[model samples]
Target: MDTILFYTPGTCALAAIVTLEWLGQPYRLCRVQKAERQSEPFLRINPRGQVPAMLVDGRPLLESNAILAHLVDRRPELALLPRHGTWERDIANQWLAYLASAFHAAFWPMLMPQRYTLENDCQATVRQAGEEAVRRELRRVDTYLEGKDFIQGTRPSALDAYLHAMSRWGNSLVDMAKDHPNLWRHQKTMARDPAVRFGTAVERGEPPPEPHALVGHVELASITL
Candidate 1:
């Protein structure tokens, strides 16, 4: 299989990268600079001009959740998703949609106000609303994680990967560690996971280092324009 992933640092691309690493799959990494995403060459890979687009056998795949599903389905041994007939599958689907539609979408306008409106007043209002929505979504996840180690059970699933990536945004925008204990613990746990560490290192343009304890480590870095 020839797989090439076009990714932007610290974006939703991290989830797909983590999932691919966990599956022990070998693939080429194509860095997509934020400023160049709109260029013709990058646009050819994904007309949407989005990162985390995967090219499998030269066929393009866009959207993080879709790429994640493809990866897990193609590598069943990784067990990122539950068995076909289980309730876990449904729960996994729920969280996938939640991450894609709810958590991830909530932050888009705030990150890129130009797409939403040209007016400063309208853009500010939209950005503020997006920020508030993000906070609310974090609380929802925190509550859901209260008594669970992972989203579905003891082991981390694809949902965990999705949530971990989206949660990183919260860590950057909001001080989740101070406000949400369960969510904070989840982020800490994910930071130590081998796949997560590798994915994050790749996102930050750093090499993977020896494993270390991550109890007090913060998962997200401040994002600047």
Candidate 2:
């Protein structure tokens, strides 16, 4: 398939990047700055101007979860997902929904406060609420990872890739390592995984951080959501 991934660093595009790397797929990566969302060219590609939009065989696919699911289906050999009739499949779906609807959606107001409210007072309130909600979701994820290596039992399924991408934002917003040790460990592991390192490095415009630097700092309160 001739694929072109329109992406921005530290955005949901990381999800599709990770999936592509895991499948060893060859594709083009088009960098789009978040601030350029209003540009005429980007607007034509995706009126929403959102990152992680993939053009597969000339057809555009928006939304990270949809792209990931499509990749898993197309490249079954990667086995990012599980077969039908298994508990693994159910759990994978659960995590995917939780990430998209619960965790990822919480960032909407914080990222676009003006869309949420016209009043500055209301905007701040909404943004703070979103931050707290995201913290709560992170706590839930930490609990889920207490005794498991990945989201769905032992293996790193599609859910783990999605969650890993979602959690990367924690570095800018909260101290995930301080709040959740298991989750922090999971992040480190995924960051070092060959596929993840390659894709993240490409997206970041530099090499992946050293493995030692993966230990997250405890200064979470310093973040302003």
> Would you estimate the TM-scores of all the predictions?
0.89, 0.85
RMSD (CA, Å), each prediction: 6.8, 8.5
TM-score (C-alpha) between model 1 and the true structure: 0.89
Question: For residues 1-225, could you state the per-residue lDDT of candidate 2 as single tens digits?
Answer: 877777888787777777776776567677777777667767766789788777788688888778888888877766788865778777777767778888898777766677878798798888888788777878888997898888765667667778888787776777777877888989998877776786688776875444322222122122111
Candidate 1 lDDT, 37-125, residue by residue in tens: 89777777788898888878878888888899888988776688986677877778777888899888888887777778888779888
Give each model's whole-structure lDDT: 0.79, 0.74
**Clash number for every model?**
0, 0
Weakest 10 consecutive residues, lDDT, candidate 2? 216-225
lDDT value, residue 138 of candidate 1: 86
Top model by TM-score, which number? 1
Candidate 1 weakest ten by summed lDDT: 216-225
